[model samples]
Target: MQYGAQRVSDINLSQVRKMFEQASPTAINLALGEPDFDTPKHIIDALKNALDEGYTHYSQNKGEVKLRETIVDKLKKDNNINTTADNVILTVGASEALYSTVNALIDPKDDVLIPDPGFLSYREVVKIAGANPVALKTSAENGFNTTLDDVENTVTENTKAMIINSPANPTGSVMPKDEIKAIAEFADENDIIIISDEIYEKIIYDKKHYSFQAYTDNAVTINGFSKAYAMTGLRVGYLSACSEIIDEVLKVHQYNVACIDTATQIAATEALTGPQQCVSDMTSEFRKRRDLVVDSLYDMGVECIRPDGAFYVFFKQDNPDEFIQKALKEDVVLVNGNAFGEMGEGYIRLSYAQSYENLQTAMERLAKIA
Candidate 1:
């Protein structure tokens, strides 16, 4: 009579969203990964026009063809991925893409290597697929960089895949090209499938994103419109790999949502091909916020590492739980880094998604605890 699947019981909501829900009404949230910007008017306009033009119906089961084509072109131009529209499957968001692809590729008891202090969704999805989630430990001492040695030690006959996030959530550490090459080389030698999550690719500061797809035919590149285009609510994201792999993922994607909303697909097409200045403007502002928060951490004398990309700052705490409690008292919402993984125990993740003014106020409150 007990109906809930054991996997559903194990997977909790993301700590970022949980913390936001728990915060006092007056709290300035520096926890969630959501960008605090409104979706650009052009994208919204495209959606409205799409609706007026009669795009309210369901699209192809794999997704809207035009949107998938745009994704193919974007992948070719921006990420150096050479793939056709047939290989791209649009999904609800990167969240859905990740879940579906993991399900498609992993068998029960297979080990999927994930970075400790990586994105919140990686482990849970692997668990949902009935795989053993293995952690690849990364440290602030090395810029939180994932190296070949760390990956090598973790690989084994049971290793089936690895979920890599550049401009990672929580930590905001961008994996470097050399490190990526090493990973690519290793995965090739061992036949490990690499799932590259490049959701934060466009928000990086002064660094070009190098996709693992560029280095391996076996890699799956997952990205979305939410982070870069400020279209989070639209729920547009896609997964790209070889046609063979995409064929399998499409089975799962098709049955789940069947298809993305037609108008949203049109909006996503506009996001990829439209004027790109908005993305530049947003990332420029994020760079400023990144600098502002990192500088504030230094000013407060907290031991912190400057996150290279994305909009988070990672600060070490001897007791992250106690530190989080203290920060809550200051009315500054913060997430214990342990929410990321066990290796994240001594740290806390502070996202800079708020405005310069709000971040300044949050910093002022956090400084009281410092």
Candidate 2:
């Protein structure tokens, strides 16, 4: 008997995982983009302290009061977005925040503009919500920057929201400030809701992150500790919006996970309020890795756009599918661009989150494949 919902069935299998089942145990995995660093000791200590103080119970449905307050200060100070604790809802991760936002904002057949070659989760979340995902095709020629013209031309009457990821995934390019300003203006005029996924904001290189929420009250800003603090295991993230949006999203957030764990919340709070040296050190290392990967790739005669932010390098080569298959034969893992979206075809994304030594080894493996 066919019992499951069609919407769930409609979601495609992950491209990032296509060869995962077949991958050799010894493969040098450059496919996943998680930071290789450990969570700082201070953050861990905060979690321990919270647990010792009997913080195991459920927090407010929105999240812990202290965490929300920290997030409010963070938004104002780091992102230049003025918001209050009432506007933020802590979630399991940015994944949950994005999903809850999509669920709260979209109905079946509603169109949501998501960047092609964007984060793997974006399309899946929209599809699972029974919403139509309209691909905002970005290109390598333009440094993969999503332009205002791109969004303006693609909007349909059915369009309700647009997802913008600076330091975008699969490309590793940050949107220029002008593009962000233009898109913000267009969004304002068109009444389109903006979902700015700034999870990588803290990992940027040589550029300041311009949060769309800074430009419009209609924006929902989603961020988490997974990337910045090496706290992926903690599973804490959050979203900030005007009260109306927060209220609606909290209804879904409340039912989906109710609240994040008390200890995790405390750790996340420390991640924000503690000395930020860990973040600086992690970014400095990531920058070194990025340079090593780019320089090494060039030396190997492979062409790639030097990423402005995040810990990935995205580039294209001839016969990428065959190249990917052959690379796997050598036990070096790389994600095909098509795995991200159509606009991503003929390209590949490799994470530089590993050590310079491991990356050099992987680059050597890539040389043989090329």
Candidate 3:
């Protein structure tokens, strides 16, 4: 009676979404990942202007030329990645960028290395591509950043690719530059491709975000405006790689997405070329929220590392499932650590992307149960 394809028969809905859906309407949600900020005024104005200018049609399958060119300059100036417009593919969001890249490169039965407590999508996408996902177990002792040793322990002759996320989801740990370079060099030596998710690059605090592509030609960089510019609904993101990879990835993108919305692509152009004070201001505010949440958890006698980047605080709980249930009873929603991976079993991730006022209230509510 199942109508679904066998390829997706084993895939489950995101646990993050399940928590969000089951929470009471009055619950303080810390389960979702998107920033709480409204899209900046300038970008909103640009979207409106684009619509007025009749940009309602499909863009080139590669995305709007202007957006791609802007992304090219951004890669050079911000990421030190000297890629061209032809090497970029604008996707629906970083989600699409991740999916398309995995589908384009991974083959059935191939082994792909992913962080143990990594983003859920990485494992699901690899499975969807009919590949095996090898976990590179990271730990709190290591700030949850994947090390070269972690790579060495998990890699096999069947390993074809690896996915790395800095300022990683669930954990919010930013990988150090030296560690990233070490892994990049290791990948180079082994002839493995690297898929670096830098969607959180701009949300970093007290650290610089390094693009893996900067360390190796055998890397695909996935990023978007969703986190940085509060453009999640607009669904505009892009991937940059060598032209050869781009030529292949384009086939998956062209059929699956055709092109991103023309108006949103135009708006994305403005998000890059326009003033960036909005981005800095948002990061500064997130810094304040991050401190509040971390300090509050510590005050409640819970141990957790201060995240170097991103707006999440993954803290240890002896029974994360029980803790999550207790949190829900107190009207404060959180995601269980096990949702990320086996290594995440004793921890829970709390997103501080909400308003400072809301975070304060949520923390107070959590303190009641902690």
Candidate 4:
């Protein structure tokens, strides 16, 4: 059969979702990267109240006006990013926000730099956008932190953008502010756009998150309510960039998904402005889980950096694929590390989004492995 676009073929499937789908009734799941906590009750009530208030019409392509305004207010207050409503675009999720940004910026034959062992979706999205996905290697040796030198070596004349994640998925490693500043400066010097995915900004355990746009003007900051407010089902996220880039991405979004669900937008607005106590509470619990998981892994001779933020623990195993398989057989479903990228061969990602009881049970099972 004559195939679909070659770029379509290049998009690999997501290992995290696949592993999550196969989590048996008897399995202890640490494969998903969402909070186990319930969505803050007020946020849920806001959505219901919106529905009751006849908010069923299609919102503006960007999002509900109030939500966009809320994003502007929250960005300025939380991250020191002075984005206006014109500079923000809301999408179904951060995944869609990422897709829109990638599709908007990348051109045929251009190159995009993504961290090796980074978000599994980055490489595929770059390929599908018809850009070469260049992997910059990071390692457990340095707590999975990518250095400026590592980023510099990967840059080329054809390089159009770089995607960065703090409190990074799989590893939960927050990029240091100095490193983030250096990268922002480097991107500014090269006239490259930086795609900063800060979805876990509110879930940080040990350190504060510094926005890339705080250090430089050349960045698109992506964040969502899913990770922070346990609103994964709401499917609401947003991107903030300079107005010029926002205008460009808005076009791509208009052609794809015209707008996010109206109720979700209202709910997300409440999530940003309502009681932030839920965010603080869940993150504190995650910090406790981080300690428990890291301590357990160390006791089992599995070396890993204690993540200063986020709820994941990426650790080395004897043979990651084999270890994951065995763990599944033992009713502990963990994502295989290589699923993230080539540099993740001996590593496995453990999410502490599950209950402490579940995480402790999984850790005990892992420790008993021969």
Instruction: Write down the TM-score of every candidate.
Output: 0.98, 0.98, 0.99, 0.97
lDDT of 2 by residue, 175-230 (tens): 87788888888999988999999999989998878988888888999999999999
Can you write out model 3's per-residue Cα lDDT over 1-370, one digit (the tens) per residue? 9898898999878999999998999999999998999999999999999999999998899998888999999999998999899999999999999999999999997999998898999999999999999998999999999999999999999999999999799898999889989998998999899999999999999999888899898999999999999999999999999988898899999999799899999899999999999999999999999999999999999999999988899999988888899999999899988899988998898999999999999999999989
Residue 192, model 2: Cα distance from true site in angstroms: 0.3
Output the worst ten-in-a-row residue range by lDDT, candidate 1: 7-16
What is candidate 1's lDDT per residue for 240-269, written digit by digit as tens?
A: 999889989988887788987789999999
Which candidate ranks first by lDDT, i.e. highest? 3
Clashing pairs in 1: none
How many clashing residue pairs appear in each of the predictions shown? 0, 0, 0, 0
List pairs with backbone clashes in candidate 3.
Answer: none
Segments in model 2 whose C-alpha atoms lie over 4 Å from true places: none
RMSD of each: 1.1, 1.1, 0.8, 1.2
The alpha-carbon deviation from the true structure for residue 351 of candidate 2, after best TM-score superposition, in angstroms, is 0.9
Candidate 1, which segments miss by more than 4 Å at Cα?
Answer: none
Candidates 3 and 4 compared by TM-score, better number: 3
Which has the greatest TM-score?
3
Q: On residues 1-370, what C-alpha lDDT tens digit does candidate 4 reach at each position?
A: 9577776875778889899888788998889887889999999999999999988988999988888899888888889988788788999899999999999988978999998889988998888888899988888778888779889888988999999888788788888878988998999999999999999998886688889998888999999989899999989999999988998999999999999899878888888888888988988898889999999888887888899887888888878878888888889988888898888888888988899998888888988783
- Distance from true location, Cα of 18 in model 3, Å: 0.5
Cα RMSD for predicted model 2 = 1.1
